[model samples]
Target: MSNCCSSSSCETTHPKKHRCPANGSEYSEVSARTIAHHIRDALRWRPTANRYFFCDDPACDVVYFGDDGSTILKSQLRTRVGVKELSNDELLCYCFGITRGDFIANPANRDFVMAQTKARLCSCDTSNPSGRCCLKDFAKPEM
Candidate 1:
């Protein structure tokens, strides 16, 4: 659940990158740990030892892909991928459970997330499907 880069499986000295078959977008490297946390228990056994990537394309059903031509769709995950969700209620910050709607309602939520993140309380690695920081995903309030 810690930094994926620290894990041996996530190390990418010579990564074998792959594109998302569903959308044909270049893959973003991800950790098996991230896949393990997001993937449904039944599908946990689906992953191979190969490196994995995250498909952030909202229009695509695929959430994870492996260098060995394996894939895990959003439907196979334990939690809804916020980026893929069409609803404003989709979670933007998994660590604090802040949804798009909540952030839109109160921009202060962003500040709270920032504070928590700065305090080293955020755990985006396991909670977030992308295994990345959620601060960049926050929707800025309209002035």
Candidate 2:
């Protein structure tokens, strides 16, 4: 992990693992492959040989922050971070392209996703910003 925060833009407190620079929320660690999938082409070259964390805080602009204090803002991502979006149209299942609205309109979507997941067809690790199973987001399907 590159803990070297020599840049002036570096806003994180060094040595602290997985903290969002914008909101200070404890973030979830994500792999470079996950970063590469979500980050836009312009910022694809930004991922260095360092540890990256995903900030699920909807209020925070920093989506991915490195241990070195480097950050990739939400606007830098190719897809909308579902947890960060307030609209019902926000995507919920990346692997199946199911939106929050769809999930709410049909509870069966969740079951479908669960079935697909059980069948090993889901790819949340590279599709979702959190790099976690979408089923967790389904805990409270109320829109």
Candidate 3:
């Protein structure tokens, strides 16, 4: 499974459900292979685990898991991956290194940025820290 942020169709047809042991928050399963590639160093891949989960809570860092019901902590996870909520100074566009502050400071640039992203002007799949596209998050009205 590709990262959900990569494209509009990243959602699973039948998301495997699990309750977070750390937070009791319900989460859907994602591909272990995808998670492994995203956080290769952080994850201790379990041969028995077929799926993994990502805790979207910014306050939580329990990002990766395995089939054997194990998890990887935030400290083990990669930094600057854009998986966490963007701090004011953090890059929203990992490919172009555009920060949230840049957009807030100049709202007009948002459209231009969106246009560039929609046109596939950059290699987001390879360049993005999350190994996904920014458009799904960037194009949100709340952003």
Candidate 4:
């Protein structure tokens, strides 16, 4: 037995339907293989700025490197956001003007994990919930 397919001459006979998007952009599902082929084009470099999140929270902003334990997300770019090798803590300190303590206080901002970095999230001073009061930004003494 042989199978048969038909060529259509009318819109009503078409097997698929497409709708115009209000956003003026057309979207359709693409096969995984087709997407993988464009990996190089998708992964291109762009301009960047200095490290760290612009955190205003006092606790999060002024974190330093520790000799023990892992490399946490502090004093660096937003690691969560690709193209930037920083952490949320850095943003709190530099970009947005927040501190590590205050930034950590807000649980929602805890976006990504940091390891093998200079700064990372540390235990907040339980006695003083407001990291602003506990953590102060002081210039490191010249060594």
Candidate 5:
């Protein structure tokens, strides 16, 4: 997938103001066309009509929104969906059955895990409880 904001036009244009549907947090706009195809497909976005808005609030469930005032997609909405606020002991790499504790135990293993993920060898998109790639989640520093 392409970088989240690699397009020149996206860089030059000012982001439109919007609010998160989940938490009413304000955010800058991002064109749906500029986001990765997989993300767009997963969100089922209509590029022409819906402008994308990203929310960084961890407590908020809605991550992306449409300019039409619709919630296009969400993350960390429910535990059943496999999106949860992970604790230190919780598993981090569902595809390979790796946990945060496992990574702490063997920090060197991170590289191997990342390589497998990058190669798409790990079935995170399907197997992961969140129904999304684990790499981005893993990359975040533990809180």
Candidate 6:
């Protein structure tokens, strides 16, 4: 799938404004379209025969499956999907897109992991002064 913002024009007139989907939390999937896009994004990386990433936004609290396969394979992702310890093994895992399961050595995969993490951290929050959110904590976590 193309990037979440790809031709999405999910953008709004007010840069900080985030459209909340009626289905769930303002930070999570605001609509079916958002969910679909994320699922597609997850599917784009699954190299195995039938592996998938599961995304449940803390904002929305609604669990949706990034089904690279027919069904939601939580068992597989939680059980089989892992940080590929073996050398030169093609794999993929979803740690909310922060960690890449593909050996953690492949340059392209490294970029992908970084991008995902960045995207997740991208401002989608509506609680900020700008009515948007961010993954990174500008403030100290300990404070």
Best by lDDT: 1
Per-residue C-alpha lDDT of model 5 across residues 76-125, encoded as one tens digit per residue: 22222222445556666777877776777877667888899778698764
Report residue 96 deviation for candidate 3 (angstroms). Answer: 2.0
Candidate 2 residue pairs in clash (backbone atoms < 3 Å):
none
Query: Which model is ahead, 2 or 6, in terms of lDDT?
Result: 2
By descending lDDT, how would the candidates be arranged?
Answer: 1, 2, 3, 5, 6, 4
Model 1 gets an lDDT of 0.83
| lDDT-best of 4 and 6 | 6
Model 1 residue 26 lDDT? 91
TM-score of 3: 0.61
Tell me model 2's lDDT, rounded to 2 decimals. Answer: 0.81
Better of 4 and 6 by TM-score: 6
Error of 3 at 89 (Å): 1.6
What TM-score do all the candidates reach, one by one?
0.82, 0.81, 0.61, 0.15, 0.46, 0.21
Q: Which wins on lDDT, candidate 1 or candidate 4? A: 1
**CA RMSD of each candidate after superposition:** 6.1, 8.0, 6.7, 22.4, 7.5, 14.0
lDDT of each: 0.83, 0.81, 0.62, 0.26, 0.59, 0.31
Stretches of candidate 2 off by over 4 Å are 1-17, 42-44
Clash count (model 3, backbone only): 1
lDDT tens per residue, model 1, 1-143: 55877777984567546788778889778899888888788553766747889987778989998887788998888889997786888999999898998887888899999999999999998889898889878853331
lDDT of 4 at 19: 22
